[model samples]
Each structure stands twice: as structure tokens, then as C-alpha cells.
Target: MAESPPLPPLAVDIDGTLTDDRRRLDHRVPSLLRKWADAAPVVVATGKALPYPVALCEFLGIPTTVVAENGGAAYVERTDELRFVGDRRAAEAVAEEYAAAGHSLGWGEVDLPNRWRETELAVSREQPLEPLEGIAARHGLEVVDTGFAYHVKSPDVDKAKGLTAVADALGIEVESFAAIGDSANDVGMLERARISYAVANADEAAREAADHVTDGTYGDGFIEAAERIRAGVD
Candidate 1:
């Protein structure tokens, strides 16, 4: 008899899903990922900047591409190649306007990896997103709140689009991957994956979009999803 087909790749969001907090990754994540990487490829799809995801891929020793800037850029770790597709001019213009108008917008509680980004402008999540939303709408831009940071980008850029780019580069179908996420920016990829999971800590929108909600939070939830994927338990 023929052997069963191989499992598809695993795509994960960086913040809130893979890490316990902004500064910490789950201790169990590396080992579990080592096992999973042997079975299938792993991709980091996030709203983070290029360096952060690229560094993560390096640390994991996973030869995978990273989707950064909330889909604004895709970086191939092995080749050290970076591609930028997100249009941030309009967003930048709007941000400047808001700043000039006396909004206290700046990088949030954590250090911003994309503070010097060219494809997107991110501000602290502490600010009201409503005004930015209205401003973005008028300028044909999209404002995405990732819980930790608010990303202003083109409407065409999103996590799903980033996943599609990675899948294309790997010669795989988007439906062949499983996705894990925990925020509004993750919604598109979550809905696009063959199977999607949201951590227990996810917000309502993400939880609602996911195929399953893991009982654990943060890294634990991610491990739970990975195990279930290995088990083929759906």
C-alpha cells in the first residue's frame, strides 16, 4: 500500500500565540517545533518587523520564510532575501498628520521592531484606533490593531496575503497549511487555513474566526494545537 501523504506546513502568529508575553517564548515551543519541523515546514506569519521574525526563524533553526509587517514584507531566511509589498506612504502621511494634530501617538509599551519600517507605520495600542480608522479610510489605507501595536498599511496587505506568498515560494497550496493566531490581524490567515486555532487568550473576533479554540493560553495553546495537528484529530 502507498504511504499517506505528508502533513502540510504550520503557520503561526508571533505575539500572543507563540510567546507567553512580548518578551518571552514558551520553553516547550522549541522542542515541539523541532519535532513538527521534521514532519512539515513551519512559517512565522506576523505583524512584526523583518528582523524579529528573521531572528526567530534563525533561533528555531527552521529554514522557513517569514511574513512581516502584517503582510507588508516576506523574508526568506535561507537566502537572506527580503521583499516588500506593503504600501505605507499614505499611512505615513496620515500618521504625521495625526501627530501634528497633537495626538500622543508613539511606539507602545514594548520596543518596536519596525520603528524604522518603510512599508507600515505602527503606533502604540494604547491610543484610540477610531480616529486612525477614519483617517485611513479617507486615504485608502487600512488600520489594524494587533493588541500590542496598531499597524497602518494598505488594504491589500494582510496575514493571508503574506501566507499566500510563502506558500507560493514553497510550491504549496495555502489550504495545505494550518494556522494559529490570536488577534484581528490574524483573522484572515485563520480563516484561510485548512485548520485554524485561537488560543484561550484570544479576543472574541479571533476566537470566533478560528476552527478551534485551544484550552490553554499563549505557548501552551500553541502546543495543544500542534499536538492535535500531529494526531490528525481536527
Candidate 2:
């Protein structure tokens, strides 16, 4: 087997890396993550909102910090404390731009305004490119084409920034970290790590950017990556 990189702090993306297509966490992946957590701090950096990944961490019984809302927020699950990092002013500006271009913004919690835990915006599926461009230009937000949904978020609020914050808090250098992900949003976290992995089902862009591609999908892919890290095989 090829020699794997040294054990380092692990930062993983949630949606496609930790959860299966059904959005369920694999039974095996949690054990592997627990093993790594015992060795070093394991952080979950994702674009999901707080409650989503926080529940996952609780289930895994790992001491994990979460980056949610595409980097708009960070939270320490054990403490129930949160940090808001994204530039809201910039986000508002982008929303205005989208409005001017005749595109409406849809929130993940559009129906439950008071209960919405975080701010997430989706460009109107009916909107034309002009509005999309305006939205992107105004807030300096990136337009993520997810096919089913177009995610618009502040450029600074991303998985990479979340991982960086975790590293800083832990006093670990960037070279001593590994990241695994499977989406365009995961790109930031992947790029920040000393080692990066993409799952078999990863999108083309993600696969192209990854240093290594796992053979499996979802939680199985994470298990594969963890085994490689444990066996010292890259």
C-alpha cells in the first residue's frame, strides 16, 4: 500500500462525506470518527445549519465544532455557544441586487421565519442570469449551482474558513490537518488541508480538485479514508 500522510487533525464535510444519499449517518463511520477524535480533535465543517450537524455530533459522541450556514456561523456543540462570522451587510446588499434584477431570494426557512436557525438564501429558480449576476456582484457572494437549488453565500463564509477557525482554536498548523468532502462548497475545506479527499460520488469539480478520491460513497467513503489514514496509506 502507498504510505499515508501522518495523523493530523481531521476536518470533514457533512452532507456528502458523512451522510449517505438518504441523509443518514452510517453506523460504521461514527466509530471511525470516534477513533480519530480520540487521537486528535475532529471538526465537522459543513454548509448545513447548526442543529443539523450538531445533532450528528451528539450522535457520534465526539467533541466536535461545527461550521454552518456555509461559514456564516460556527458553534461548539457541547457548550451550545455560537459565533456569527459572515458579513450580513454584504449579504443584504446581494439580496438587494437580486431584487433589482427581478430575482427573489428564498430562505431555507421561508415558511418559519421565527424558527429559522440560520440565514440561507436560494436564488429564484425562475430568475434569469441577469439577476443571478447582480446577486453575485453585489454581495461578492458565490453562486453555487446545486441543480435543485442555487446557493448564494458570502465569499468569506465557507467550509475553509470554518476549518481555519477550528485549527486556530486548537493551536494546530494547517499542514497538520486533513479534510474530506464531496461538493463545491466542500472545496474550501479541501483546499485548506494538508491532505484532501473526495468521495466516489463527488461532483466533477470536487473530484478534479481532490488530492485523493475514495472508492466508496457517503459514510463508507469516510471509513475508507479513515482506514487509509490509519494504515498510513494515502
Candidate 3:
């Protein structure tokens, strides 16, 4: 189904799409994903770090175009093009404020989520959002709850920008991509794609942004959307 007649490329989110309810990888998807990779160019867009998306694609033997750290960075593997669009220091400042208050990120104690994160910061959902939001506002940053964690980054660095950057690098249009996801952080990317879908379990913002909602949940929903795309269903 590799775009024989030039259908749009595909942009996918990993955590809620490729993972099950527990956020663990679904064994069924890797094999099915190769067929997806064959359908069109794939962009692994996620709020995760740069290494996460790139490594996942490499392991799966898929082409790598990543919008990582919620669009804080965009990297295209074939061209060796990499662009970062956010200020890391804002997140660092938020960390400092948290430290002063005797708190650490990602449930404290050597915050693993932010370890490889090059830009912005991710706080554990256990942290209170009010104070964090206040701190973020003061620093001109915004906090997004991606269900897995609380992401603190710039409003200007949404996934849409990252998708656009990746599309341009591939000589494609952002509007020519079909996107899928299940969280608020994915809203911008969903809105930018020509056709977008929300997994049945998607959060409110994501569902609202998507043009369609699949009957399946999580990975199944993703696969369903991919099949529809391959079948050329509008």
C-alpha cells in the first residue's frame, strides 16, 4: 500500500498508539508496522525524547523522521537534518523552583524521564499541576499533560511545527500527512494533518481535534486508521 497513487504520508504517535493500556509495547504492532512503513513515509511524533523515537524506528527498521520533545526538536534521518526549536533553560528554571521546594522531577529521586530529554522537561503526574503551572506561566512556558507525564515546554514548540519541519525536509506538505494519537499534546499535530483520527480511548482534546474516532482503542485504533489509509478511504 505504499502510496501507489500518491496518498499522503503518515505521522504517528508512539505511546498511546503503539502501546497498550499500561503504556507497554504491543507485540502485535511491530510486524504490522512494517506494512505501515511500506504504505507511506512515517514520522514518529511524540513528546518523548529525541533518542526514544529515533531508536524505536531504527529497531523496527523504519525510516526515521521524528518530532520529539513535543516538537522541541525535529530530525530527519536520511538528510541528516536536525532542528531544535525550544529553550531548555526554561525547564531548568522550573526544576530549580521545584528543587527549592524540596521536589524533584518525574516523581523525584533522579528523574529518569528528563535524563535523556534534551529540551523542556517532563514531570511525574504525581506532581501537583497548580504550582507547576504557575511556575511555567511565570517563565512563559506551558505545561501539557500527555497522560504519561506532565510536559513543560513552549507554546511555539508544538508537534505541528515539528511535523511541518519534518514534512518540509522530506519534500512533502504537512497537510499531506495523516496523523493519529490519543492525548492533548497531540492536538496540534492532529489539527495540521489532512485527515486525523483519535483512538476511541483518546482524551477530550485529541478526540475533538481529530476528524474521525476509531471504534478500537489504543493500538487497535491505530491499526484501524492505518488500514483505512491503505484502503484509500476518505
Candidate 4:
């Protein structure tokens, strides 16, 4: 019999998966990431700005891709190819509407990453999501809560779209990959990949969408996922 194909690359979330809610990477994560990189491609899919994810990839000394701005942009490290995927104007409009609602918005309190994002507007999660969804709907936009913040983005653009693009760029089948994340933004990608994991700390919806929920939380769960993938458990 022919040998089964090797597992495809891993597409991982940044905040709340590889790092804690406080935004610190556990010491174990980098080594596990390095090992994974040695075995196959590791793409960092995140709601963070391009530079931030790129910086992490750099720090790891791993040649990997990044899907940033909640699927709005992706960078292929080895090729230095950058692709922008979402509606920037729509995102800005959503931000404006949210600001008009008199809620503290952008670069205040908890959303420092707001200034760095160009295609997704970061809104305070403290603001009720129901009203924010209504505001987003007015412009045909979408709102996703990423634990730390709420993101205003194009309804059609999301992590799944970004992951597909990265898979295409790498000439790999999307179904061959594994996706791990812990928030509403990650649900789409989780559902799309053949092998999907929701870390123990994942948002309820994300946990529901995933094929497996890791036994550990945050970095620990991510490490567990890596082990499961290597073990070929469905």
C-alpha cells in the first residue's frame, strides 16, 4: 500500500492560543513552534496588525506565513508576498459609526492594537455586541469578538478566506491543514479545515465548531494540539 500523505501545515491563532490573555508567550510555545516549523509550514492567523504577527514570526526564526487583520491581509514570508483581502473603507466606516455612538473607541483603554490595524477596526468588547452588530449590519459589515476586543470587518472577509489564500499561495490543499484558535473570529477557519482544534479557553462558539477541544488551555492546549496532529487522531 502507498504511504499516507504527510499532514499539511498548521494555521494557528495568536492571542489566546499561543499566548495568554495577558499577551505573553509561554516559553514552551516558541520551542514547540520551532519544531512544528521544522516539520511543516506554520501560518500565524491573527486579528493583529501585519507588523505584530510578522514580528512574532521573525522572533521565532521560522519561515512562515501570516494572515493578519482578521483575514484582511496575508504575508508569505519566504516569498515576501503580501496580499490584502478585505474592505478597508467599510471597516473605517464602521469605526466611525461606533465612535459616534459615544462609546470610548479606538486607541483607548483596552484597544491599543486599534492604531496598527488598517483593514479591521478594533472596538471595545465592553460595548455590547448586540448593538454593535446592528451598527455593522447597517453598513453590511460584521462584528467578531476576539476576547480582548471586538473587530469591525467586512462580512465576506474572515479567517477562512485568509487561510484559503495562504493555502493557495503555498500550493497546499486547505483540507489537508489544521487550524487552532480560541475566539469567534476563529470559528470560520475552524469549520473549514479538516483537522480543527479549539483550545480549552476557546469561545463557546469556537469550541462548538472545532473537531477537537484541547485538554489544556492557551499555550498548553496549543502544545497538546500539536501532539494530536502528529499522532494522526481524527
Candidate 5:
């Protein structure tokens, strides 16, 4: 005679979790996510710049709530709230030091990744990490590698903080949400969510941090996790 638990809302990663290995949007994903949005809130969290995730929510027909730039910015649609982690002068200094040390920003002179980024900086993954970490540390910043790129940000800021902001804005606790991810930047979110899923192709840290590891990869993995969450199955 025990009552069933409530279905949790979702906070999801965009790139490797929603896109295929080619990083292309899986045509099946938007519609599936749109369906889920009808029943519960679905947060599209990503390490990309703010505009990307926000626009994604619009196109996907989900709430525009999102955590972008690897926790550097949090947007809550319900309250029209937009918050940034902190001043990025430190991250900017890191980039200056990195450039002086003969390291390329990796994406070329007019790097598109850094174009709209407000609170952090992104270096292409192709660049070596040896001195980049040291450079960031000197400026009191941390460099997080999200598989697609390396993000220079404040040590205290992360996707978990963004999730907390979203929870607060929605007047709910984060424990009432399910989260899925495929990279290191998502580790904090996965660990804090009520239920966490790491796709088959997820890195070691993410897999180790999740409650479940999906059998599929990319968009398919998200589908699997979503179905399991709805079924209330582990």
C-alpha cells in the first residue's frame, strides 16, 4: 500500500549527451525532449556559450532555463534570471599568460568559442595542458577539460552551482531532478542529482560518479536514461 515516488525533473548535458559522435544533433532527440518538457522541467545545460544553450531551448520547445559556459552562467526562465559566476578578469589573465608562453588559443585568432563567453575562456582541446593548468592556477583559475574543449574558470564555480540556481529559481530542491552527462564538467551535476546516468562512451570520472551507466551512447543514451527515469527503474 506504499505510495509511488514522484517523477523527477531533468537537467541534461547538450554536446556529447544530446548529439551523436559527430556532434550533430540527433534528429530524434529534440522531439523526445519536447515530449518530456510537457510533463516536467528539462534544463539544457552545457559548456558552450550562453547564447547557444538559450537558443537551443527555444528551438527544442523547452523552457529556456540553462547552465552555460561550464557553470559560468545560469539562466532561469521562470524568473527571467541570468547570473554569472564572477568577474572573468582572472580567466582573461590566464589567457594572456598562456599566449605569452607560446601557446595557441587552439581555435585560431578569431576563436568562436570565446566570442560570446562572458565568465570564462575556452581553449581548443588540441592545445597541450601542461602549462595551461599552471597558468590558470597562477591567476587563481581552474581549467576543466570537457572533451570538446578546455575551459578556464573559477575554482568555486561549476555546473552544480548552476543547477542550484535553477532549483532555487523554480522553488524546488535539486534532489528532485535527474541528471545525465558525458564529460568531466558534468561530474558535479551527476553526483548531486537525485538520479544520474553516464552514457556508455562517458569518461572514467563521469562513469564512476553516476548511479547508472546507459547501454547506449550520445542521443540514444539520453533516450535510454529518460525511459528508465519515467519507468521508475534503476
Candidate 6:
């Protein structure tokens, strides 16, 4: 039998990696995360804003840093320390630019009544576009095509940046990391890690980019990926 490689720190995506298509968090995934946390740091990196990951970490009983709003913001929950990586002034400038171009930008953190633990930004289509590429080209933001909606985001803010930030804070190198996800947004983090896994339900782009493709979906898929990482296979 081949010897297993050393286990690495885990960075996981939220929506599709740990939850189902409906966005409900599964209990088993958190349990498995905690199990792994005993040996390595497990960071939750998600496109969702701060509150979601904060709720998740609290529910999971895992004391880990969270990278929220893609890579725009990060937070260490234990200390309540927050880092706004993306320039707020820059974000505001971009927002103005988009608005001037007649594109609707849905600001994620703006309307929330309570102060957020992390920074988050979401750009969505308020009106239909005849050609989607036009908007993307105009703003230089990546256009993500969801089944029902279109999302535009800064090219700089991505899952990979978030993962790297968390790893750096924890003093873990990129080579000693594993990433798992199921979307185009997850592609960066997937590529950044030494080992990357895409779930059965992952998008084609994500699957193609991943080092390994898991047979399971959602939480079950993540569990399977964790098992494979523990067992050590490229």
C-alpha cells in the first residue's frame, strides 16, 4: 500500500461544499470539520457575507478565522478582529462607476441593520442585459452566471485570497493546505491548494480545475473529500 501524504490545513467553501443546493447547512459536515480541526486549522471561505460564516462557526463550535465577501473582508472570531482587504473607497468608486454605467449593484452589507463581523459585497443584475459580457467587459468584473441570476464581482476578491489570508494568519504555508468547493467562485481556492476536491454537483469549470472529484454531493461529498485527504491521494 502506498503511504498517505501528511494531512494539510483545510479551507472549505460554504454554500455548495458544506450545504445542499437549497443552502441549508448539514450537521454531519460540521462534525467532520470539528474532527479535522483537532489536527489542523479549518477555515471557512465563502462568497456569502460575514454573518453567514459567523453563524456557521458558532453553530459548528469551531474557533476558526472566516474569509467573507469573497476576499474583500476577513475576521478572526476569537478576537473579533476584522480586516478589510479591499479598499472601501475603491469599492465605493467601483459602485459609482457601475451605477453610472446603468448597471444595478446589490450591496450586501449596506442594508443590514446590525454591524457585521466581516465585510461583504454582492453585485447582481437588477435588470436583464441583452448581452451579459458587455457588463463584465465594461466594469472589468467577473460575471458569474447562476441559473436564475447574474453576479458581478471584483477580479481581485476571490476565494483563493481569503484562504491565503487565513493560512498566513495561522502561519500555514499554501503547500500544506487542502481546498474543497463546488462552484466557479471556488476555482481560485481550489487551484491554490496542494490538494483540491470538487463535489459531484460542482460546476464543470470547477471539476476540471480540481485535483480530485468527489462522488458525493454537499455535506456527504465534503466528508468523502476529507476521507480522501486523510488517506492521501492526488
lDDT of 5 by residue, 5-112 (tens): 566889999989999999999888888888788878888889999999999999988889999988889999889999998558998888888989999898977888
User: Candidate 5 has what TM-score?
Assistant: 0.96
lDDT of 3 by residue, 30-52 (tens): 77666667767889899999989
lDDT of 6 by residue, 1-234 (tens): 877666788888887778887878877886788877777787888776677787788888888578877776677655566766654444444546656777655435563411342332345555545444464556555556432234445667777887777777776786678989888878888898999999998999889989999989988898899998998877
TM-score, candidate 3, is 0.94
Tens digits of per-residue lDDT for model 2 on 147-226? 33465676657777766665666667856777788888778777778788898888887787778999998888988887
- Candidate 2's displacement at residue 188, Å, is 2.0
lDDT of 1: 0.82
* Stretch of 10 with least lDDT, candidate 3: 1-10
* Model 6, position 189: C-alpha lDDT score: 84
Candidate 2: regions farther than 4 A off? 1-6, 76-81, 92-130, 146-148
- Write the number of the candidate with greater lDDT, choosing between 2 and 5: 5
Which is the winner by lDDT between candidate 2 and candidate 4?
4
**What lDDT, from 0 to 1, does candidate 5 have?**
0.90
Instruction: List pairs with backbone clashes in candidate 2.
Output: 4-232, 4-233
Candidate 4 residues 1-234, lDDT tens each? 865456568999999999876879978888888878887889999998889889998999888599998899898977678888777787777777766887556466665677668787777666668767888888888887888888888878888999888888888887778999999899889999989999999989999999999999999899899788877878
Which of the two candidates, 1 or 5, achieves a greater lDDT against the reference? 5
What's the residue-level lDDT of 208 in candidate 6?
91
Report the lDDT of model 1 for residue 163: 82
Each prediction's whole-model lDDT (CA):
0.82, 0.71, 0.87, 0.85, 0.90, 0.72
Best by TM-score: 5
TM-score of each: 0.91, 0.80, 0.94, 0.91, 0.96, 0.80
Candidate 6: list runs displaced more than 4 Å: 1-6, 77-81, 87-120, 123-140, 146-150
TM-score head-to-head 3 vs 4, winner: 3
